[model samples]
Target: MPTTSTGSKSNPARHDMSVILVTGSYDHEIRFWEAWSGICSRTIARTGESGQVNRLAISNDKRFLGAAIHKKIHIYDIGSASSDPILVLDKHTNNVTSIAFNSEGQWLASGSEDSTIRIWDLRSPGNIVHRTYENGAPVNDVIVHPNQGELISCDQAGSIKQWELTDNLCSHELTPAGDVPIRSISLASDGSCLVAGNNKGQCYVWKVNDESTSLPRFQAVTRFLAHNKYLTRCLLSPDAKYLATCSADTTVKIWSISPGYDFKQEKILVGHQRWVWDCAFSADSAYLVTASSDHTARLWEMASGETVRQYNGHHKAAVCCALHDGAS
Candidate 1:
């Protein structure tokens, strides 16, 4: 709601109650900003030896910040600017690319360039409960389902694997017919369906039925050729009414899904200067945030399809980003 200048880089994190946490990249710090006012309430910076931060995830309670660097996961106690991480997870041999905290905040999931996914128990430092590997492709993203005891992982090969945390084994694999490399996968809040975008500039939605035990498969309910280039990211709105996708074609499209049976496309959101890497909807589904290779993140009004605010200034391409409400 608050207005700011373009060319400013801020890593945004959403809290439980919908408040947003905004952090500045390249400047080497994090800031807690009031979502509506856009005012900085707190500032934390790297103090010791760590330099640049690539990705960030706040704990469920918003008390801790988990940052991914080249090869380590640094856990920082919020409000403390000290350079030291309360816990340093070094299980990934390659760079830690992404991290996420479960709804309970009891477990942390991390994916890395090593083509593996690791789940860690927050109660026990350095205790990794599960470590699973893909044949060779790097694990690009991992997300914990809202209600189910499952985690979904996507890799460079465009394959999506669902792992049951309780058993710590892959329960299902959703592979496209053409084997197009999947860029991102997000589950609807109801846990009944999943939407995935691939490098082929196509997006597919799968209905997850629990009955089939043979091979984990999904019936493709809807397909959208939204971009001419690779589709980099896909996000489902909180209400599950809308799905937003970003692509290498330098545009973002919003699709409306019919309520009960058939999931169909309804609209398109088009605005961006270059390839869009990531896109997310506000908690209310009224606004959208997009990060692009042009080194800027723009906020879009969902209803009107207008560019509201732009956050720029990253020295290099902006790869991944999120919006935080600040309750944590």
Candidate 2:
């Protein structure tokens, strides 16, 4: 993990090269912030047919920021002075719901409401899509396994499908909770656990086992109701120590990951005025950043359960945020 700069928090001009935090909103703009200071350093207008930003992802190498808007994915240069996007991937027919980068940062993976998942090769000059997989249902989330050999995706039909990277085939299909729509999915960075959350505020857990198979198998662990309202997003800490779930109830709940996969509620982050849409864990897994419909994003300390910094520049609802604080 990288340590944040020891500079003054009120200094807006001092930018720390170690940390990068950005937020996208219905306000039709993306703001780059000084994470420790809560200062908006740069603002890029996201206008035209791209529509509102639905999700945001930072490449592992911290070279680019991928924004999923409407039916297109815009890639922006993070270290450059220009505000223009260097590349735009326009292949999805419907809204691009989720986006992520591979561990090497050589490729990008995205899932869409068009019922497909596409892998874009970042090293190619023509911006070629390496491959595409049809999910048969609107995909809500897709994540690359830590082993870099597979992809796991959850859809509106309440199905979790595991795709094998080597053979390009679906190896496992799991319907954890009947036919309810699955809103989000998260995998532990160490490949120890898999979690999926649904519209009914339920969360299901599974342990990743690699016994006698080339593809990792999911052993059922447990399921619990994490929220009373809609569960908007679920994310696992990079260290696999905590699970964070954002809800329409305007709170983010953190669950402690026990040794035996017994997850228990550790804290409930209160303060957001409206729906808590998205959140990201610091590389050290000690802090959290949350975006809300209240048009603000806040940084919270896990142990203290208090807001350490508040980012309040968005004109409309802040829907998504991306953070990269350490090298992969």
Candidate 3:
């Protein structure tokens, strides 16, 4: 069942059974908010060279949370009361841009400005790198396929690369937008569709074929102008019924997805004063939480297109958010 924010303090010690609504900001702090109440229930100080969080991901089991900082990652035990990170992963040579946990949460995949994608084995003694894939340009986003046998990544050079786990090779490459930075990518949970958002504020959709081979083929479905300014992130709802795109235009637009990958405008979430950087959908696809450079994060009710809650505690730009409501 989807967890509700009941105006109570977040019990980090009970994370596995509680709702998690976390946002990371340039203020050098990560804040956990009571989703519905908009209360900042917990805060953790982050200090480093960059002092800004680029991305955040919660393990599928809700046992751990990962924060991507400059050239490193901080992994936190969600059940712990300590404010310090349980493990610090320092492998990337440049800013780590993105991070994601596999379905089983046994490992984490990270993409970086270092031009590489690396998998960290959480089960290993020191959480060592399990595998690494080299890209020609700075990586922006990376995600694991639902089958856990492939990885897909997009880079600053606007190229999409698919790496096969068994062969340890890049099986396919596509450049939908030439030479422009592709900022984000989202794969449908069932692995049937892929969406990439670029600096030009355009989004490319593809139909994925993943059933027969280790390497999936992508067929161009459609391309559309998602925003007039840079598109920071594009995420497919967990239930695969909608797509959410946040941009430098200061708005988050929701698109309904239909058969054959047709998309129609659904809602325009407007409230942030600065760049809308990231967003995460609720497990049931009924709600969306967005982070913005305005130093706040807001929860939007999809059906009504209204801001249900506003989380305000950050002193600087809030760039990334992670939410796990235990319904997966």
Candidate 4:
């Protein structure tokens, strides 16, 4: 279990979980933290020649960590800490915004600002499995289906496209009638629904069916004006029972989604002095972690809407964060 700390600003950032990774805008470094003690574990500075680190993705086994910088993807071997990435993939023509590894750790997908998505095979060296494109907006986020070989991608146009990884073809396109650009996308663990957050501080839930046809269809289950400001990130609980969203409005909300996927606002967590940029849930769904422009990351109790602890050490804004259980 992770221990709670009650110290002042003099103390280092605590690491309650196994490993914590943070990406900063000004520093251009991906800093690792010891989860329970809030201590700086290691700092992986961008290679002497690379641009700022924009995003991060850890493999399912926790043996590898991927960082997106400029138009490249840097893969680091976290099994041993040398601060140097083992492989640097420079194929995207524009800034690589998001990357995700499938549950089996066999495939890796990267979404770029160039309006393209690339799928790479982990088993083969320098092998590109699939490459697909969306109409012409930066592909901001990409997520693989929980149980199938399909990929879901979202962009600045608030449209969702489904691509079949094996065939390297876009199977379907889902454009919600409105024009709010989607900032983030997340799929439930059971693969029953897909949730998207937009720039208008709204979240939309869609029921997805795989058995329907080649072009999978979606039905709008609910739409929530979650906050007064733009939404930055959204995540679904491990059990697919709740959806958590963070926004520029300086609040994080947890919404109940089970038994019919209703958008009942259960709790609104607040403490950050600036925009809440990112939020995540623990593996067991017992805790919530948030990264903000306030130069601090906070851990909150999911049920009580109380901030359990705060990790404040970054001199600048903590743009992105990832929680690693360190199973490997």
lDDT of 3 by residue, 138-226 (tens): 99999999989999999999899999988999999999988898899999999899999999999999999855776548989899998
Q: Which stretches of candidate 2 lie over 4 Å from their true place?
A: 1-13, 47-50, 211-216
Model 3 misplaced stretches (Cα beyond 4 Å): 5-17, 47-50, 211-216
Candidate maximizing lDDT: 2
* TM-score of predicted structure 3: 0.94
Q: Per-residue alpha-carbon lDDT of model 4 for 120-192, expressed as tens digits?
A: 7776776454455554788888988887588898898778888876777777787773566888899988888
The full ranking of all candidates by lDDT, starting with the best, is 2, 3, 4, 1
| Candidate 2 local Cα displacement, residue 203, angstroms | 0.5
Ranking by TM-score: 2, 3, 4, 1
Model 4 stretches with alpha carbons more than 4 Å out: 1-25, 47-50, 127-130, 212-216, 326-328
* Cα lDDT tens digits for candidate 1, 1-328: 2333333247554322345544434345544444443455565556565545556777767677787766778777765656567888877788777788887777788888798888878778455655565536788788888764788888887678888767777877777745677777888877878888888877777877664456345656777675778888888888888888888878888878886535555556666677787766666778877777786667788888888666645555665565754244
**Every candidate's lDDT:** 0.70, 0.91, 0.89, 0.77
Superposed by TM-score, candidate 4 places the C-alpha of residue 290 at a distance from the truth, in angstroms, of: 1.4
- Candidate 3 lDDT at 184 equals 93
Give the candidate number with the greatest TM-score.
2
All predictions: root-mean-square deviation over Cα?
Answer: 5.4, 2.2, 2.9, 3.9
How high is the lDDT of residue 101 in model 1?
Answer: 88
Between candidates 3 and 4, name the one with more favorable lDDT. 3
Could you estimate the TM-score for every candidate?
A: 0.81, 0.95, 0.94, 0.88
How many residue pairs of model 1 clash at the backbone?
16
